[model samples]
Target: MMVQIENKIILVTGGAGFIGSNLCEYLLSQRNKVICLDNFATGKTSNIQHLLSNPNFTLIVGDIRNLSDCHKAVSGVDYILHEAALGSVPRSINDPITSNDVNVSGFLNMLVAARDAKVKKFIYAASSSTYGDSEALPKVENTIGKPLSPYAITKYVNELYADIFFHTYGLNTIGLRYFNVFGRKQDPNGAYAAVIPKFVMQLMKYESPIINGDGNYSRDFTYIDNVIQMNVLAMLTENPEAMNTVYNTAFGDRTTLNNLMEYLKKHMSQYDEKIASVEVIHGPNRAGDIPHSLASIEKAKKLLNYNPEFSMKDGLKEAVDWYWNNLK
Candidate 1:
């Protein structure tokens, strides 16, 4: 796929991680000079080792928490795609201080660097967790509830800081509030892994995936390609209204855990028929987990002209294919 923007130097902060690595590859393929800054905390080296040989791609082994590292990474960069942060809600619950330091303090450092360096745009990875305690079915960008966890608090803080940076220092910014994103290169081994990859891996290994809360809870499961489209749109959008605001990056549909499991099992069964027989166990609901999440992508569609290409099932099949060829 052709990346929308090219020839300009772009900085991706978590470029060794799932989403960021993909972004780096896409940008490089589009003939952009891409700089990847990663500390590799949760990001894996293997994810980006393929790009080290690309002449247009430069790798910076650094952390966003450090202002100097941010400054270093931002030098000569035309745009910033800030994807670095501690992502999981449960991980934040267990270690709020660390999550705050990386997601909050680190974000501030990057903004300062971008402002100081005068980057053309500062786009970032926000979270659907920002919807928080709100009972709204389809979450809009403006309306939000009190954050339910420290991770959510940190993400909300990122939006607040970005808004202030735009208002105060005139740093042009766009925040993409990502829903439950899943696809190729996503981590499925860790304890804080997202549901789809974790479940996919389990089913592949013939292990039962534990469903937290009877598999009724649902999410606005988004694909990585959709997310990449959002970042590209955010970066290249000429609309004045699109700047300094947030957009929900999602496929704009909801899928229950039961349905998600059924889809995963069905797809994985094509590769290994035994996978369909893998039982799904029910467990108590996880703390800090919302019952349901759905996003109104109308904001993105209206502002950024976002047209997500993959639905849940389409993305699942692609992801299953990737895991089979790569991991299984």
Candidate 2:
């Protein structure tokens, strides 16, 4: 996947958020002009504050719900990594309208802008929740089930719209259906914070972490680097088969909630031994929560030649170190 890195203007919507910020930083390191569009609703200034002074970095404070904002952001962008959306199943479950507005309507706005701008490609953040209610192990790209949550519905609609754009307007698009992603810069606060970061912060504080189910529920829990790699390949790939499709962006492994806590405790304990003594509590399985989730990344591996560099253990250890040093 080592093609000559081009000096193109790229727009990362939600570039002030966790994954988008990381992508922005990496793109900047490669000396590309990066335009970041965010409303700061979920995105934070702290994430992109480090890049404010960089010559190639620009942040447009705007919402994607406004087609004008999307048009303004995409004006000279060579590619669009459309990561702007309201994430979190619980959040979507609690307020489907807001999530629908941002994730659905906002996504359409970006697509129209990208198509009108004639961007080279549109790579977006799809979700593993698209596999909703399916009882299959190692979920594949084609075999999908009925969506269980409003969040899943929005992500699935993204794929459908992406397909239509390619067919109707010849806009190339790729959707990365991410699993339980975790790594540095991921927020550990807030009610809808991801499990790994939330647990790491709780353990660091010597507080209890609640497992939603009986601790048997598992997830692929992909690392940010793996996700970044998938995005890059999606953006630069020349294979026609790779276009107008979706791929599972994951580490291709699963860890139970209990096992995840053990790893977090073990890694964070290296910084503060008391974190190991922190108690873990269990609660009733959350509503709309699935028992297990795993992805078959063979499509990405074969099509995108995606070779994930980090395993879940490798990623967890690195994430713990970053949190320990940066958050504390």
Candidate 3:
């Protein structure tokens, strides 16, 4: 059964993280009742601190790895947005077991709880890394290469399990394959920090930023707003064609790392002129890194009517302005 957005009870796991927190705020603005589940591993309370006062929002500090917590979080929820997982390839490469525990086992636990609770729909955060080693430009939904890292494997497993639940148990599941999502409230100090926020932070401090692999490697860097839109559409979409399918949630454009640095510097320079002169250091390609990634948003558009509002340049400007004001 399709669930309406207004007044629906929604559970967003990892709702205190970058994308999750943004989703929480969006859902609440729509007047939906939202429950946020997090163990605070990578998520911070500060992300959702502004929304804490809203009566429509509730926070549960619990690990998804625990079945009881999953059950507890899913209770009385009409929709489930599973976003809690250990992210980053390097983090997984260093500790595959913990990644497995959180991304794989924890995902299964959430699936069981959501299914048993008879939730109307289950939407999850899939990754573009699942297109690992495929050498294909503008990756499509059906075609994918073998996963390159523990993190990639975990995200791939999410799609696989979601498919299984749909076939076997009649769970309505949709996976949104996110590509390099970035925006405000994104942690800039973490060791596995994403490119945009990290670069913005370094430039704000007038520090040199590192460009991996000569900055030629490009990515389909998505904005947090686009991801939030996809989640809402996934949960609210009533089109039979959209249900139980994976859609690439991206802008369908590519930006090279070198070009991205130039753009970032241009934007940051508006606040501090010295930032425009900051040199970017080059480094070797990191392991489990893709040479390039671009998503074909045709599926999302045809199925979910997804129309991304921000391009790379526009999204970066907003992100840079946010980091400049908040971090500095």
Error of 2 at 296 (Å): 0.4
For each candidate, what is the lDDT? 0.93, 0.92, 0.92
How much is the lDDT of residue 150 in candidate 2?
93
Candidate 3 ranges with C-alpha deviation above 4 Å: 1-4
Worst 10 residues of 2 by lDDT: 1-10
Best by lDDT: 1
Residue clash pairs of candidate 1: none
- Cα lDDT tens digits for candidate 3, 1-328: 1122688899999999988998898888878999999999999999999999999999999999999999999999999999999999999999999999999999999999988999999999999999999998889999999999999999999999999999999999999999999998899988999888888888888889999888899999898888887888898888888999899999999999999999988877878899999988998999999999999999999988888988988888888888877878
Question: Candidate 3, TM-score vs. the true structure?
Answer: 0.98
Model 2's number of clashes is 0
Candidate 1, residue 249: how far the Cα is off, in Å: 0.3
List runs of model 2 lying over 4 Å from the truth.
1-4
Q: Each candidate's root-mean-square deviation in Å?
A: 0.9, 1.1, 2.2
Q: Point out the higher-scoring one by lDDT: 1 or 2.
A: 1
Candidate 2 local lDDT, 9-128, one digit each (tens): 999999999999999988888788999999999999999998999988999999999999999999988999989999988899999999999999999999999999999999999999
* lDDT by residue for model 1 (1-328), tens: 4237879899999999999999998888889999999999999999999899989989999999889999999999989999999999999999999999999999999999999999999999999999999999899988999999999999999999999999999999999999999999998898899999899899988999999998889999998899998999899987898899999999999999999999998888988999988988999999999999999999899888889999988999999899888987
